[model samples]
Target chain A: MATLSINSVRKSFGAVEVLNNIDIEVEDGGFLVLLGPSGCGKSTLLAIIAGLENSSGGDILIGDKNVNDVHPKDRNIAMVFQSYALYPTMPVRRNIGFGLEMRKVAPKDREAAVQRAAELLQIEHLLDRKPGQLSGGQRQRVAMGRAIVRNPDLFLFDEPLSNLDAKLRVEMRTEIKRLHDRLGTTTVYVTHDQVEALTLGTKVAVMKGGVIQQLADPETIYDRPANMFVAGFIGSPTMNFLKGTLEQGDGGLVLRHAAGTLALAGLQQDVAGFVGREVTAGIRPEMLDSGDGPASLTGVVDVVEPTGPDTMVIASVGGQLITARLGPKDRPRPGEPLTLTVDTTAINLFDPVSGNRI
Target chain B: MAATRSRSKLLWDVISYVVLVGLAFIAIAPIVWTFLTSLKFEEDIVTRTMQYIPSRITFENYVKLWNQSGYPVLVINSLIVTTTTVLLCLLTGTVAAYAFSRFQFKGRTQLMLGYLVVRMFPAVLMIIPLFIIMRQVGLLDSTIGLAIAYTSFLLPLFVWMLKGFFDAAPKELESAARIDGTTRLGAMFMVVIPIARNGLLATCVFVAIAAWNEFLFALMLTTSQGSRTWPVGLQLMVGEFQLPWGMLAAGGMISILPVIVLFAIVQRAMVAGLTAGAVKG
Candidate 1:
């Protein structure tokens, strides 16, 4: 296993800049996932780390050695691509053993390593079959086998589970995590999948528009987002952003809007600087509990979506839509009045114009 | 109504077979006529009515063409030139084709367009320049000179055809090979080329056939008995005074036999390659 460090790396393709001053480092055996939407340069950064594409400026160190001039083959890194990218002409055995053969490992040794990997991946029966004959999930295993057999300093996965169906994707995601646990190799996985990022990564770097928006552990990234973009991008059912003017009420501080004013008396964050200014309140869907108490806010339900475990009710509060993931039993009807008690401490306050968290 | 439809279908099937049989006969008529003429006595070929059958058949024409007429030497020369051209085009053109398909070098599109423009011109248009260069290089009246001429004309088509194959083969395989510790060129030959071998084989057959049946450059560049190809030798036998129809027919049969055999061998491979999804959906 090896540590990977990117030092202010930047990349440009002629005049179109792809990555702008990217800086991230993962310790030995740490799983660092670079997560972002498409066109966010997460893949570009992964490619730069692999030494497949050169960075326009700055340095990359793999295992404490500068790899700016090293070739991908010499970098001692194996990558699993989104397409699987298995060699179609060769059988699964040779596909898994290719890197060992290229490194000039003895035939007997290569055969043994190939066997071990096949058993590990439960692909011993598929050794003689070509990649075309294998199903999508089997191909994915063989691709993983190809990477793991080499036992390189680092493993790179470029959205490796994105091609499978939803059910298979979940199965393969768990399998990948199990493999990482067993191998304990430093790995950098790039994906736009937040669930994969949350489940698989020891550290997650949320990227957007060629910049790292937030780099933290998954829990921290989900709970304390760096900005409005991170708060909006990371969560499912999405966090509701309520536009309101912060005011000093008789009781304490409150956020007043077209919806009923929300009490913010015991907020952990200091809000004295902008008592009268407008701010956006970010609240998670689950944090809004269904209640008809005096403290609860009333809103008209807009849409109801059942997701097996919970039912999501999209409701308009003060003319703004907010989603609440309540008990599946609480299947609120459209146009019905719904009372939701907000979690005061869970509110993530952000400046309206700057989108910076306060 | 169903019974009438079935009866009409039978009629349509009969008409289709008749038309197909008629087309097939027209296609093979020349070859059948040539084979029959080769077996016939010289007297039967000179008849006023086009003789469909000869009362007497003789092997004398084949025997004479194989011995006295230098027909064997002409056949050997054609084989050498065509085989050499096909090999030259397959080896060098595949690499160029792979580059054109995969790499994004500056002027790559322009260079490919230039190759296409060269292909658009008639081979006859290049004959004068090729002939002058052959003479300047002192390779005139040689099989190698003829092979070189064929290579110049056929390589562009080989490169163009194989580029389509290489493009269809994913670039990710080559990238995987590179990461697996193979050089760029090594990955191309060891990985990319093997996957695309059927296309290369198809191109090889086309290049060989184009060079084999070539008459214009073969006629102009090589006038000697030592280097003359079968088509040139056959035309020469149709003398200004009297045509040796039987001997020329025998030589024509010899010229096309190998190409037919080659196609029979490669047809299965090309079909298999097309169906095998190199990139799965």
Candidate 2:
């Protein structure tokens, strides 16, 4: 219901800084995910936005009002914690209605709001049971119900699905996306799971070492990462980084490495100045096909793994290992010479020195 | 080898049972003897013969002690003092413990250490100063005066026990409450306190037991029977030369009655509270 703006927010615990001049903005009804591995300060950033933590410098605005000095209650935000953090002693009905009670809503109105939230979460039968009596997934619903019953201006989730098992995590992830779509409240969710970020976020901010490495749409983040770290962090089986020298060749540019030279096409960004310089070639695992093409790399297969739908083939290109996602039927034995066609248009080239896209 | 192991295990169990039964007898023998002595006639007690059981049981000792000794008033005084001490300790200790568990102030560690240091010293060392202060404050022989004195020592114990329980409570619950629309204090009352109430009850019972049986402070602080606790009254019953063995035994039995009743009432809750923070749910 409200746009959140965090401008140059910094947080330090004593002398050790956890968040470094963070600036992020979410439009009204937008889902922004702060995604990174642990210790990346993504959770700290979310806590700062919720007014649960203070920023050493800068301002936070909810809607149009600066909320840097506001108490968490006055900020009108609801948070779903990773632990579910339900009141263990209260039944689900009172747990969901506690916020309205604190806000001094009338008894009848609070009951109705709690009932509506329970229905939305499909936990009406659980209204009289305490959190300890609920299963992991049911506890998660109660936590969500506690948040949605307030109808607050912002919804903050701190890795709310991380505690569930894998299948439950996926199901809750879809349930959360469905709720967001139905409610359309501006939400800031923190998670280290890239797939969750890709699926749930309208805008994903990939963070590292307390810095925002890349902030873009999920597709852009996956396709055109800003740096080598972003490229390497966003994909499973990871992006292949070929350390080689970039040279001007007959057709366009070619990379010469320990392996045979590979032709590079679709040079979208200018790299003419680095003709004789060392640059790293980035390629997604799924972008490599088994066959010869205009731009291809040949190597000896090192390992083959079939994961039902797709096969992963690891091969030593010179001395560096590269993983390619091939068709399930394309299984080459170890030590077999294999050539893979590179989706040249999707390939990325980065400066080896700075790891920046070129 | 298997036969030898089984034989040794059976022997070990026999030895363990023997040791446990001996310890139980040592603990229970004095109470049993006291109960039997309280039922004996004065002649049976004064005789030179070793009489473990009275030939004829009599209620004379109990009736005389309850009617002539002013024992009921002392019991009432002990109740007032113990109740006041428990309330005072809970009122101050719970807040202090919560603050210690939640906040990181400049001197929190030092202040907590200071509370421990107060308990480290001998209780007798505080008696003179406490007596003088009580006199100056006009609370010298009152039940509230003794209660205040008890709180001074028992509050540290209450705070330390309650702090563990408060620390076991999840901080995330408070954060969730705050975001759900409660102030920090409101969150504490609504979420933290209720979660920790079991531990609070256990701690109250602990302090109450300590105050109830405390004899030294009760004896030193009180001047008259009006303010004296039952333990002091029981000790005072032994006249310089005349020790009324039957009456003293009956009074000992009577003094422990409330403590036994309290334990029976809160036994289950106390055990659950004591083991509360030992595991994660």
Candidate 3:
């Protein structure tokens, strides 16, 4: 419904800065996820967006209107908290309709809106029950119902799925996505879970130390992260960082390290200045496969873990642990020499000193 | 080894029940004794033999206490003072506790500690100063004055207890309410207060009991039967040489009736309220 732009926003507690001059923009109807680990200020950023907490500096504009001094209620935003935060005493109907009641909406219209929300959430049967009586998944639906019924310009979710179990978290994650697609409201969601960020966000702002490390679509953030931190943070089983020297070889640039040389091919980013300099080559686990090609890197298998369809082969290459996602049939025994063909085009190169993607 | 462990477990359970029964009896025996004494005839009460139970159960003492003295007026006075004190403490203390629970203002810690310091003083130490102030303000002998005096001493305790309950109420709920279009004050009334109402009730009952049984200030401040609370009235009934054991026991029973009824009403809610914050929502 609205575009949210946070411009140069900064927050500090005493002398220690919590959010350093942060800037992000979410287009109308775009889902922007602030993703990071705990103490990384993702929730703080969401709070600032919701107007629950004031930024020490900068302007937050929700649909061209600056809301730096606007009260949370006046800002016309609805938030679904991690704990759901459904009014414990109110039945589900009243919980969803409380905003309308606070706005002094007519009873009939309020009931209709609440009914619509409950129906959409498939929680019409729970309307008369209190939050305490609801199961974890039911409470999550009620929390979402409370948000969507308001139909605010922006929907803010602060790790709303964190309280649910693993299966419920995925289910509610899909539920949230379906609601977003149906409502098409500009939403800002905050979570430390990388999977949620990648799955739910149209624009994922991966943050660290209160700074936005990378702001891009999920694929780009996954395939070409801005730096080592984001490259390391956004994937499961994590990306492997091979410490090596970048040297200009016969064909193009190749990395020389303890094990062998890995030819870097089709690198979209310029790295001519880093020739003969040490650069950390980042590789995704799934990009490595069993091969005896010229670009193959061999290492001693340290650990083998088979996870249903895939076996994770953690090997020691140049005395550094590197995990390769191989097929279930390619289970290499520990202490065996395992050679893996690196997907050279997909590899990321980062400056070892600065940790910046080159 | 297994047999010895089972035997030890049985011994432990037996010892625990013994201690628990002993404690319960120590607590309940006095109330049981008082009720029995209230039911006894004056002859039985005054006899040289220590009669545990009455030879003849009679309601004479209750009738005499109710009709022969100013006990009814004192009961009404105590009710008014306790109710007023509770209302006053709740009115001021809820807001104070909420402020203490939510806000991080300058001197918050010091102000809370100051409330505790006021409670640390002996109640008797405050009587003279309170008496002088009450007399200066022309409120020395009225129920309202006594209620105000009770509030001064009990307000800190009320705030301390209510703060724990308020702290247990999730701050995120208030944030959600505020985002849902309620002001901070409105959110507190709509969300926080409703969540904490049971605790509030428990706190009200506690303050009411304390105000009801308070004697030192009432004894020193009130001069007329119109203003004296039941405890002061009961104490005054103990004439220099005449103890009136039966009437005294009857008065004790009368004074505790409201407290017992209140406890019975709020017992389940109080237990639930105490345990409400043990788990996350």
Candidate 4:
């Protein structure tokens, strides 16, 4: 139940910078997720906070005290690794009790804490078994149980669900969310999965190239990403971008692409000054509709993917492929001429040169 | 068609068995011959033509060698030296290995390279200098001195091998332990050591075998039965013209028995431990 703050942190290994000028603060009992792709330095940041790695520069404050020089044990943080690194030689009970033993907790208290964690994690029956005897999901829970038994100031998870199969990952994701809600421990989780970030984090820090691109709540990060990178990274069936120029047409400004001109319906008021300049128009897959109406863009269907609830239609307009997520029943087959109405209000405009949302 | 395929498969299997059996016999014959020779009488051992089996089986050579010569004292001395060396190698090796595996210290690479150089040096090259140092230190003919010398020669190897073992062990486990409030050293002792049990056993057995069979240093450094290891002591059974084959064979069999027994008990761990460093998951 303590807030963790990382201020202006930087880390380097020899000459290669791993983390750069990173600043993040997790409120008391808040779930903060650091989300990035592989080699993006999320894990390094997590390790730095956990005291498993030293930062080249910056202050790490855990509950108001700067912990930059503190040992991992003294920092009072518990981490569940992606591997669920349970002591293979120790039984489940001993694994859960090890932290308490290290802290010199009384035997009775240690047992009680272990029992409570086991009960909370619903792993009481697994107490006598070794990690090798447990299934992956069970091992994951025992790893979590081991962390909970310590009841440290902060709980750190490094892609804890990534090791599980798809269904198990989802189940454990929910379990972790529920566990966080119940315990209300300030947690910093690192994962490359955007969905996990969206689902579990109260605040998500999106990173790339060893730098924080944006940090915000899930909804804001999705709807109003700070830059093109964040916008492109946060969505599935990702947002389609059309390289075009904004020009004043018949009635108002329209985006002129290679294929055809798309009338700027509601965007003109916000983007009036960018006329005749090149810009990248961003549109989500779901914003493209099939019904012909005002503000419609005509294209030929290239591919249709039915994903049970919806159909993802890939349409080529002016030789550029655009994907439209539409109702499964309304999807046009390949080679069919289709009219997709664009939702201009949800359109995002980025400067083509700098990739900054204009 | 199926019959032809089955016939070919059977033919291949027969060839495989023949090749394997040939190799096995080639490997096992010496050991079997040594065992039988140790059980034959002295007169029967010197027969011009070899006999696979003896008319008279006797334990007399073994008993005579054990009582009449310094063979018993040599065996005891070898055991003490080997056991002591193995234990000390394990102690120093485990600590140095843990440090090498887990820490990011100044000169770590240089230190590892230094250890590799120590292991790479031929044992024969060190014999003279070691003998001189031992003589100067008044450690010339003592089992304790031999054990210490053996440990110095063997420690680098044990450390090198065990460091590879420890390096293969996931750092996440130790980090988890430390995060759980264990000190760095405590995490190593409590978590790393337990997980590395197979490796520790493998290293101990390797060091024991190395110490048990060491002959050059023992011959160069020790003078009498007080420090004479089994390999050196067994050579004493040989004469210029007439070799005491039965007694020498018996002593060799005695010297090799404990190692075979030790390997048998820990064979699985040894194989697994040797291969542990190559794969991560």
Candidate 5:
């Protein structure tokens, strides 16, 4: 129901600055995930948005009005904490209704809202149980129910599912996306898990060392990262970087590595300034396949890691070590020469000095 | 061989039990003796023969202590003074503790260390200055005056112990409460305080016990029954001429009763809270 905008927000704690000129505008009903590694200031940004922390210098707007000085409760936003921050002493029923009660809602109306949220989150049976009595997944649902019952203009989540087990984290991830689709309240979620950012966010903001490296839709963040940091951070078997200088081939520009040269014929980025300069060539592990593609790199397989669905191939190509993803059925043993096909269209180039994409 | 090992283990257990039981008996013998002496008549208590048990149990000693020594008035004064001291100390100490736990202001570490230093000082060393302050305020012999004096001494210890507990309560919970629509102070009272209930309960019992049994300040600050606590009255019962053994023992037992009852009621909570914050709900 509200569009959230942060403009030139800078946060500093005495001598150390945590966030520098953070600006993001989440359109009405947009899901923005602040994605980064640990100490990336993603959680800090979320806290500032929720009014739990004050920005040293900035203006925050919800819809049209500035909410910089507004108290967290008065800002009409609900938050789900990473720890699930449920009242330890209160039963699930009261925990869900606490925000409503704080707002001075009528008891009957509060009960109805609580019931609605409980039913939505499928936690009706656990309503009478204290948080300590519930399992991790159930506590997560209660945390969501607490936020959902508020039905506010925006929802803020601070790594809410990061504490769950891998399987449950996936289940809760899908549940959160489903919830967002149903409610459509503008939401800002923070997580270090790139998979979560890709699956759940409509837009992803990758942060590093208190600065946002990239801000765009998930696919854009994955497929066309603005910098090398985003490209490396947003992938699981993270992007493989090969150091070399850019060269012009007979047909067009090409990235030359010590191992081999990759044709940049289908490269989407402009290669003008990067003509003869040293560059870091990057490609996702998945983009390198076992079969012949438009390009190929012959290397000796160093190790083979079979992870059920896919086999990870770590091979030494020339002097640089590169990893590739292959189908589980194709078993390539270590110490064997393997010629993995590379997809030139999926290649990325970063300036060797700046670490930014060229 | 297994049978021989079992016998040896059993022998060790029996020896350990004998040692433990012997230690326990030694610890309780004095208390038991005092109680027995309190129940005996004055004649029996003063007899040359060491009377382990009262030949004639009498309520006369208890009645004399209760009515004649002005012990009832002293007990009443102690109750009012200690209760008032506990409440005020808790109120001010909790706020100080919460701030110390959550916020880092200038000199916070030094200030906290200063409180710890004050707590370590012997109470007698500060009594003279306290006496001067009491005289200046013209509150020397009043129970209210005694409570205020107890507050000055107890607040630092209360803040130190309770700060450790309040620190155990996650800062995230308080932040959650604030976002849930309560002010910071409101969050402290409603959310943080409730979660730290067991720790708070334990701290309250300790504070109350400390104030109730406080001797030095009570001795110097209070002059008469209007402000005198039980410990002072008990000391008076040990008159310079000769100690009233029966009355003294009765008064000592009475003094320990409240602390024992308080621990009995809240021991589970105190123990439970000790390990509560290990894993969060």
Candidate 6:
């Protein structure tokens, strides 16, 4: 296992730049995930690191040596493609052993490696079957097995679980996590699925428009996103953004929205410069409580979705709608006036124009 | 409702079969007739009336043609030329096609367009210049010379056909192989080529058929028995005074035998390869 460092990497196709002055360093044996929507240069960055594509300018250091001109084969990296790009003509045994064979490993050793990979993946019975004969899950395992047998310096996975069914994807995700735990190879994975990034990555780099918005641990990225894009992109159901201005009101500063005013107790100290200036009030859906409390906001319920464990309530106040996640027992029906308590400490403030955290 | 729907479906099936069979007979009848005529006596063959089946079948024409004419030498020459041409076409074409499919070099589009333009030009238009060139190189009337000329003509077709096949192969398969420790070239041979076997077989059959049926180049380039191919030799059988119908028919049947046998062996692969990249299913 080796650490990979990408320094000021930039890639361009003709005049259109795909990756712009990106820099990232992954620690040894760390799981680094590049998370972004499609066309955001996440896959291109991964490809550049794998030596499958050349960056127009930068130094890619694997362990310590620069690998800018190194061929993909010489880079000693294995990539599991999203398509599970198995050799359709070869049986599972050969597919898994192909790397060993190419490296000039002896026949007996190659067979042993193949057997070990198959056993680890619990696909021993599938060794003689071709890729076409395997199911989707089996193909995914075989693709993983092909990468595993090589024992490369880094494992690059380009959304390897995206093609599987929902249940199978979850199972495979767990399997990959288990594999990574056991092997502890430094891996760089790319995916658009935020959940996958959160679950699998020790360090997640959220990107937008060919730029890294935030690079931090999963918990830190989720709890303290660097900007508006990172906050919105990293969470499911997404954080609600209420456009408002911060003002020093009675006792403390409060965010005065078009719909209503939300009192800010701890936030005013950090956001004093933005007083009387428009900012976005960022609140996660789960941070709102249904019970009456000291910090409560009154609004009329516009929609309520009871999802068994929790209730999702969309409330409207003065023509502005805000979504809040509450307990299933306190789900208010539509048109019902409700007072939900906002967890003021968990609320995030961002500059409305620049989208930077305030 | 179910019974009425089934009845209409059955009617449609019957109509489809009738049309297919009609087309099939139209395609195969001439071939069958040609084979039967090759077995008939010279007198029976030239009679103004048509004979569906002869009272007696004879192998005399086949034996007489083999003994009298240089049919044996011509047959051997055709095989050597066509086999050599097909092999060369496949060797050069597959590599060129793989390069076209995988690489993103400068002028790739222009080079592909140039290949297409070469194929678009009529083969007849090239024969005169080709004839002169071959004669200047002292390659006229030689099987090797004819094979080389045929490669020039057939390579573009093979390259174009095989490029489609290679393009149908997912690039990920080769990239995966490269990551598995194989060089780019090694990955192509070990992964892409194996998956594209059907296409390679199809291209071989196409090149072979074209070389085997080539008339103008073979006639113009070859003069003596040492290098004369079957097509040229067969055309010579129709003399100035009277056409040797039985002998010509016998020679024609002999020339077509190899193509039929080859097609029979690789019909499935040929169909699959020829239609590559046209439709997904």
Q: After superposition, how far is residue B206 of candidate 5 from its true place, in Å?
A: 0.7
- lDDT tens digits by residue: candidate 5, A158-268: 999988999999999999999999999999999999999999999999999999899999888998889888988878788998887789888788777787777777887
**Regions of model 2 farther than 4 Å from truth:** none
Considering lDDT, where higher is better, how would the candidates rank from best to worst?
A: 2, 3, 1, 4, 5, 6
Residue pairs with backbone atoms closer than 3 Å in model 1 (clashes): A259-A318
- CAPRI grade of model 3: high
lDDT per residue for candidate 4 within A195-237, as digits (tens), equals: 9999999999999989999999998888777778988898889
Compare the candidates by lDDT and give the number of the best one: 2
Per-residue lDDT of candidate 3, residues A1-358 (tens digit): 7999999999999998999999998999999999998999999989999998989999999999999999999998889999898898899899999999999999999999999999999999999999989999999999999999988999999999898999999999999999999999999999999999999999999998999999999999999999999999989899999999989899888889998788887777788898989899999999999877757788999999999999999999979899999998997889999889987888899998889998
DockQ score of candidate 5? 0.80
- What is the alpha-carbon RMSD of candidate 4 to the true structure? 2.5
Give the TM-score comparing model 4 with the true structure, all chains together.
Answer: 0.94
Q: Report the lDDT tens digits of candidate 1 across residue range A138-249.
A: 9999999999999999999999998899999999999999999999999999999999999999999999989999999999899889899999998898899999999999
Residue B169 lDDT in candidate 4: 82
Q: State TM-scores per candidate.
A: 0.95, 0.98, 0.96, 0.94, 0.94, 0.96
Query: What overall lDDT goes with each candidate model?
Result: 0.90, 0.93, 0.92, 0.90, 0.90, 0.89
Q: Which parts of model 6 have CA positions greater than 4 angstroms off? A: B1-26, B276-281
For model 3, residues B100-136, the per-residue Cα lDDT tens digits are 9999999999999999999989989999999999999
Q: What share of the true interface contacts does candidate 6 keep?
A: 0.93
Report the error of model 5 at residue B128, Å: 1.9
Q: How well is each residue in A229-313 modelled by candidate 6, as lDDT tens digits? A: 9889878678988888889899788889886788887652288788999998888988888867656677899998888888889
Best by TM-score: 2
Which 10 residues in a row give candidate 5 chain A its minimum summed lDDT? A290-299
lDDT of 2 at A206: 95
For candidate 6, the TM-score of chain A alone versus the native chain A is 0.97
